[model samples]
Target: MLLTVSGPPGSGKSTTAAALAEAFDLEHVSGGDIFRELAAERDMTPVEFNELAEEDDQIDRDLDRRLRDVAVERDDVLLESRLAGWLAGDHADLRIWLDAPLDVRCERITDREEKPLDQVIEETRRRESSEAKRYREYYNIHIDNLSIYDLVYNTARWSPEGMLGMLTTAIDSYDPDTDEGKIPVEGVDYDF
Candidate 1:
């Protein structure tokens, strides 16, 4: 079962995806982790690397291509990324999207990163804006579109445990016999 967990930063994507992988006995690959690793390799922070990615499109292409390949090549895997759903295409059994309001997400990020609320908010806003523009320009993907996802949850309303339980229930309850199959993301370029 190839599953995808997707959302903006601080939406608990990595946390939930990791939990899902453990529960389902699946290999997990996180695009955020990969990006951060790459950033560190160059002695740069994620925000700095993101700015570089905005200039050099290959940075995103390489990362996204690897993620897309993993989704296609691996069966028992949980792929988590901003574009995992779109990149996974028809290969994924369940594509989940998580989100929270901006303020809620900013608070989560502040707590996780141990940063000031205002600084985190500014960085997050800039990062999100840069990424959205790059996604649109490079792949014709609109990051705001949630129609292709099998599950879309707002993280603000639930505790992390509650959210994970909800996701596990959905994964556990999937019935291929009654399954309608994936919703094709129309007009996505998927060039990366």
Candidate 2:
């Protein structure tokens, strides 16, 4: 089972993914962590890192390939990336998209990074705008589309455990191994 979790920055994607992977005994792969490592290796600031990411398409491709390879070989893998679900293609068994209000997200960012609230808000806006434009320009898919996901969770209202439990139960309910077994999420068709 390949579970792809994606959301805006500070939306608890990493936290949720980690919790889900731990609770379900799935391998957890975080693209943000990978990018951070890459940035540190290059000795770049956040803006520099973003520019480098834009210039090097191979980084994204390699990460996509890694996720695909994991899906093909692993029984259960949980991937957290901005574009994980879209990149996973048919290999994604359960895809979740988390969302929260812009203000809520900005507050989370400020709290997490201990930055000035205004600075965090501006930075968050800039980052999200860049990501949205770049994802569309590069992948020909809009990450903002809620219909692309198997489950859409409003992070503002749900605790991490609540969200993880909901997603896990949804996946288990659809597991073909159970008595009320249903096909894996890969078999489910999306209108898109």
Candidate 3:
């Protein structure tokens, strides 16, 4: 089962992906971790690296390419990234987008990063804007659009455990051969 979990900053995507991987006994790969590692190797912070990437498109391209490669090479892997769903495309058995209110997300970021809520809010806004612009320019994809995702979850209302239970049930019941387990992709819907 190739699962891709995508969301904006502080939406609990990493935690959710990790939990999903454990539950399904699948390898978990995080694009954020990869990006952070690269940034740290260069003695730069995530914001600094993100700013640099705006000028050097190759940085984003390379990271996205690596994600694609992983999807192609691995069969039972859970990928967590801002663009994981887009990158994995049809290869992913399940594509989930986690959504949360901006204030809620900022609060989560503040708590996780041990930073002031205002600072985290500003940082997240800047980072997301930069990424949205770059993604649109490079891939013709609007980050705000959730049309491509198979399932969208509102993280604010659902606790991590609740979300996990929902995902587990979906995964357990899914039948790939008959497409019986796939969520309907018609309406703009979210699972709470």
Candidate 4:
């Protein structure tokens, strides 16, 4: 079973994905983690790395290509990223989108990153805007579109454990044979 957890910054996507991976005994792969590692390796912050990515599109392509390949080739994996739903395409058994109001997301980011709320808010907005532009430029995708996903939840509505429980219930309730949840992404060529 392939599952995808996608959301903007600090929407509890990683937290939920980790719990889901444990609950289902699935491999957890996070694109954000990979990106962060790359950033750290180069002695740069994620914001810096993102700015570089905007100038050098290859960075985004390389990371996204690897993710798309994994989604197509692997099963029993929980993929987490901003664009995991689009990247997984039809290979995913279930695609989930988690989001919250801007203020709520900014607070979570501030808590997670241990940064000032003002700084967190600015950086998060810049990062999301950069990603949205890149997504459109490379894939012709509208990043805000949520129609492709099977489940869309607002993480602000629940605690970490509560969100996990709700997600697990949704996953358990899925009937692959009957539910037509795999919405194949079309018109965008994933040219790896």
TM-score of each candidate structure, all chains considered together: 0.96, 0.83, 0.91, 0.97
lDDT string, candidate 1, 1-192, tens digits: 999999998998999999999999999999999999999999998888999999999999999999999998888999999999989988888899999998999999999889999998899999999999999999899999999999999988998899999989988998755557658778888786
Clashing pairs in 3: none
The number of clashing residue pairs in each candidate reads 0, 1, 0, 0
What is candidate 3's CA lDDT for residue 115? 95
**What is each predicted model's overall lDDT from 0 to 1?**
0.92, 0.75, 0.87, 0.92
Question: TM-score ranking from best to worst?
Answer: 4, 1, 3, 2
- Give the residue spans of candidate 3 off by over 4 A: 179-192
Lowest-sum lDDT 10-residue window in model 2: 182-191
Q: Report lDDT (Cα) of residue 147, candidate 1.
A: 90
Q: On lDDT, who's better, 3 or 4?
A: 4
List candidate 1 stretches off by more than 4 Å.
Answer: 178-181
Better of 2 and 3 by lDDT: 3
Q: Across residues 108-142, which tens digit of lDDT does each residue of candidate 3 receive?
A: 98888899998888888889988998887788778
Residue-level lDDT of model 4, residues 1-192, one tens digit each, is 999999999899999999999999999999999999999999999988998999999999999999998899988999999989999988889999999999999998888889999998899889999999999998988989998999999999999999999999999999878655457778676865
